[model samples]
Target: MLEMSNGSQHQTMKLSKNSWILILIFIILLLFFSILFFFRSKPEYVSKVDIALGTTVKVVVSSDKDPGLIIEAILREFHRIDRKFSVTDPKSVISQINKSENPVEVDEETAFVIERSIALARATEGAFDPALGNLITLWGFDRINDSAFKPTIPSDSQIEEALEKSGYENILLENDVVILNNSVKLDLGGIVKGYAIDRGLSIAKEMDPEATGYIDAGRDIGIIGPKFGGEYWAIAVQDPRGDSGEYIDLVYLKKGAIVTSGDYERFFMMDGVRYHHILNPKTGYPIRETISTTVISPDAMDADAFSTAAFVLGSEFSAVLLPVLGGQGLFVDAQNKATYTEGWSFFKEKH
Candidate 1:
C-alpha cells in the first residue's frame, strides 16, 4: 500500500511540474507577441518644419527620410546663394553687371539661372523677360518697404524709355559670360526662387535618393518624390481673395512644378480699383481680365513664367498658349470662374 501511495504522489508531482513548465512557456510567448504588436502599431516619424527666409520670408519643408540637419544646411546654402545674387543689394551680381564694361563672369549657379531666364524670354515671345528691372523699379515694385502706396502712373514717354531697356535681346550671354547694356538691368526675382527650390531638391535627392522631399518658396513649389508610402504629393491651391490659410482645391503631383500669380497678394488701391504688380509688356500697366493664374510644368522656370504669362494673356489667349507651350494652367478670371487645361484634369483630386 505504501509503495502504491508513493507511486501516486510521484505521478502527481510530475504532472504539476509539466503544467508549470507549459504555463511559463506560454506566458513568455504572450509577452513577446505583446511587445511586437506595440512596436508594429507605432508610426514612423517624419519631420515637417517651417524655415524662415531672411526676416520677411518663410517656407515649409516636409521630409520623411531626410534629417533636419540636412534640410537646414540646404536652406542655409540657399539663403547664402540668394544674398550673393540679390539685386536689391548694391554689392550683388546685378551691380557688378551694371558696373562692368566687359562681360561679368558669374558662378555656375547664377549662370544657369541667367541662361534659363534667356530661354524663358525666347520661349514666351518676350512675355517673360527678366530685363524688366527698369519698369519694375519705375512702378516702385522694387522697393522693399510697404510704404504709403506711391501711385504714379508712368507717362507714355517713360514707358517708351523703359521699354527700350526691357528686352532680353539687349543683354548678351556668350561663353558663360553675361554682358548687359548700360540701360538694361537684370532682376531674377520672378524665376530664381523656383530655380533655387529645384536646386535644393536636387541636393536632397543626392543626400538620400530614396527619400521623399518637398520645397515651397511662397509662390513656387517643387516635389522631389511622393510622401512616405504614397506615390503622389497632395498640394492645395490657395484662394486669392479668401482667408490667408484657405485653399480652393487640392492637386496631386508626382514630379513637377506649380506656380501661382495672384493680383490680390500685392497690390495698391487707386480710385476704388486695385493695381497689381504684373506689368503688361505693351501697355506698361497691370494685366487685366484675370485675378490669378497657376501653371504646372516639368520645369520650375516654365511654371514660373507661364503662371505670370497666363495671367497676362487672359483666359482666351492662355487657353491656346498653355498647350502650345507644353504646359497646363489654372486661371481664375475676373468673374471668379476657375478654368484649367485638359492636362490639368489628370492631376485633379477625386473629391
Candidate 2:
C-alpha cells in the first residue's frame, strides 16, 4: 500500500512539473511577440536634400526602411526627372523638342506630360497654356537667374509679336512624338517641377507603401500620406504682401499637393510698376486681379496648373471653377480680400 501511494504521488508531481514548463514556454513566446509588435508599430523618419530642376528639392520619409537608402533613391530619382524635363539642359528631351521643328520622339514620361499639359489648357479654356514660352521670354523672364538680374518690360509691339507665336493649338502630339510649330518654343517650367515632385514621391512610396512623407520642390509641396502621428500636415499659405516667413492662412492636409503662385516671388520693379511672371495668355501681360493663389489637389501637377489658372481667372471665377475640377483654392485679391472655394473651408485652419 505504501509503495502504491508513493508511486501515485510521484506521477502527480511529474504532471505538475510538465504543466509549469509548458506555461513558462508560453509566457516567453508571448513576450517575444509583444516586443516585435511594439517595434513594428513605431515609425522611423528619414530626410534628404538636393538641388534639382534649378531649385532645392527636399524629401522627408517616415518608414521602417533604412533612411540612407530611401534618401539616396529619392535624390537619384529627382535628378533623373530633372534631366528628362529640364528646359535648360541641352541634352534633355525638352531641349531637343524645342530645337526641333519636326515631331520629335520622346520617352513615355515626356509624352504623358505633354498630353496632360494640352488637356489642362483645353480644360481651363486656354487659361493655363504651356505654349506661352515665347511670350515668357519676351517679358525677359527667361533671363532671370535671380532677383539681381534686372528685367525690362516688353514693348507693346514686342508683346504682340510674342503673342502671335504663342498658342497651345500650335503644339502637336502624334503617336509618341511632340511637335512644336516653328514659331512656338516649348517651356515646361510652370508644370515640370510639379511633375517631378509627383515622380519622386512615387519612388519614396514604392520604397515603403505605408510610409508617409513630404516633397518640397522649391515653393511647391506634395505630401505622400498621413504623418507618422496620424495627423494632417499643416502647411501655411504664404502671404503675398507679407514679408518672407509670414503667412496669411494655414492649410491642413493629410495627402496630396499644395502649391501657391504669387506676384512677389519673381517680379521686377521698374518705375514703381511690377511685371510678374504669371502672364495672361490672351493679353501677354501679368494678370493683376489676384496677388496670390493657393491650390490643393490630388497631385502637384494639377495643383500647379490650377494655381496659375486661378490667379489668371481672378477670385470670382476661381471660386466657381475650382469645385468643377475637383480641387480647391484660396485667393487673395489686390484689395486684400480673401475668398476660397467650398472645399477650402474643410481644410482651412480654425482661428
Candidate 3:
C-alpha cells in the first residue's frame, strides 16, 4: 500500500510540472505576438532631400506605402519645370524666345505665366517688371551662382542700354504667342522658384491626397498639407543682416505659402557696397531702400512676385499695396526698421 501511494504522488508531481511548462510557453508566445503587432500597426514617415531648381529641396511625408517613390516623383516635376523655364539652357522655351527676333508661339501654360506677369507688373507700377532680362544678365545675376562666374558691374552706358531694353510694355502676348521687342531677353527667375514649390506640392498631393507633407525649396516653404496631420508649421523669417539661419520673426502656417526676397540672398561686395540680385526696373540697379521683404499669400507665385515688388517699392509703399493685393507682408529696410501690414498679425495666431 505504501509503495502504490508513493508512485501515485510522483505521477501527480510530474503532471503539475508539465502544466506549468505549458502555461509559460503560452505566455511567451502571447508577448512576442503583441510586440510584433504593436510595431506593425504604427505609422511610418519618411523624408528626402535633393538639389533642384538651383536650391536645396526637402520633402517630408507620412505615407501608407513607399514615401521615397512619391518624393522622387515630386522631384522629377521640379526638374521638369526647371528645365522648361531655364534662361541659360539654349533649348528651353525662355531661351528660344529671347534669341528669336519674332513672336514665338508658346504653350498655354507659358502664356498664362506671361499674362499674369504683365498684370503683376502693372499692379506694382513697374516695380516688379518681368522684362528685365537684359538688366539681369548685365549684372551677371542670371549666372550668379555659377562656378565660373565673376562679379561684374556694368558701366553707366551699359546699365542705360539694359534699362532701355527693360520694360513690361515690350512684351505682348496674343493667343498663346509671345512677342519680345526692343531686344528684350525673357527671364522668369523671380517667380519660377515659387512655381516649382507649388508644382512639387501638387504632385505629392496627387500621388496621395491623404498624405501630409511640405516642400521647402531654398527656405521658401509650401505646406503640402498640415504638419503630421493637423499641426501648424512654425516658419522663421531670417534676418537679412544676421548670420545664416538667424531669424528675425516667427509665423505659423497650416497651409498656403511664404516667400522672402532679401538683398543678402545674392550679392557681391564691391567698393564696400552690397549689390544684390534684386534689381530696380527703373534705375537698372540693385534696390537700396529695403534689405528684405517677406510675403505670405494663398499662392506661392503671388508671394514670390509680391516679395520682389515690395522689396523694390520699399516698405511703406508695400504696407499699402501688399494688403490690396491679397497678401500680408513684413519689410525690413536698410536702416533695420521693421514694418508690417494690418493683417500681418494673422500669421502669428496659430488657429
Please give, for residues 211-297, the per-residue lDDT of candidate 1 as tens digits. Answer: 565677774687767666366777788887788878887789877788888998667787888878787876777877889888888
- lDDT value for candidate 2? 0.83
Q: After superposition, how far is residue 268 of candidate 3 from its true place, in Å?
A: 1.4
Residue lDDT tens for model 2, 1-351: 112346446432234677889889999999999989987654466777889877788888887766567778878888898888766678988788887867788878788999999988888888888888889877777667655666888789998999999888999997988878857877777788788878877887888787787888877999977777488888888888888879888888888899988898678888999889899999999988889999998989999898988999998999999889867999999898889998898887533
Q: Name the Cα RMSD for model 2.
A: 8.8
Per-model TM against the reference: 0.80, 0.84, 0.89
What TM value does model 1 have? 0.80
Q: lDDT per prediction?
A: 0.74, 0.83, 0.87
* lDDT (tens digit, per residue) of candidate 3 on 316-344: 88999999999999999989889999999
**Model 3 misses residue 332 by how many Å?**
0.5
Candidate 2, residue 185: the lDDT equals: 77
RMSD of each: 6.6, 8.8, 4.8
TM-score of decoy 3: 0.89
Task: Score residue 21 of candidate 2 by CA lDDT.
Answer: 90
Best-to-worst order by TM-score is 3, 2, 1
The number of clashing residue pairs in model 1 is 0
Which regions of candidate 3 fall more than 4 Å away from where they truly are? 1-44
Better of 1 and 3 by TM-score: 3
Residue 204, candidate 2: alpha-carbon lDDT:
75
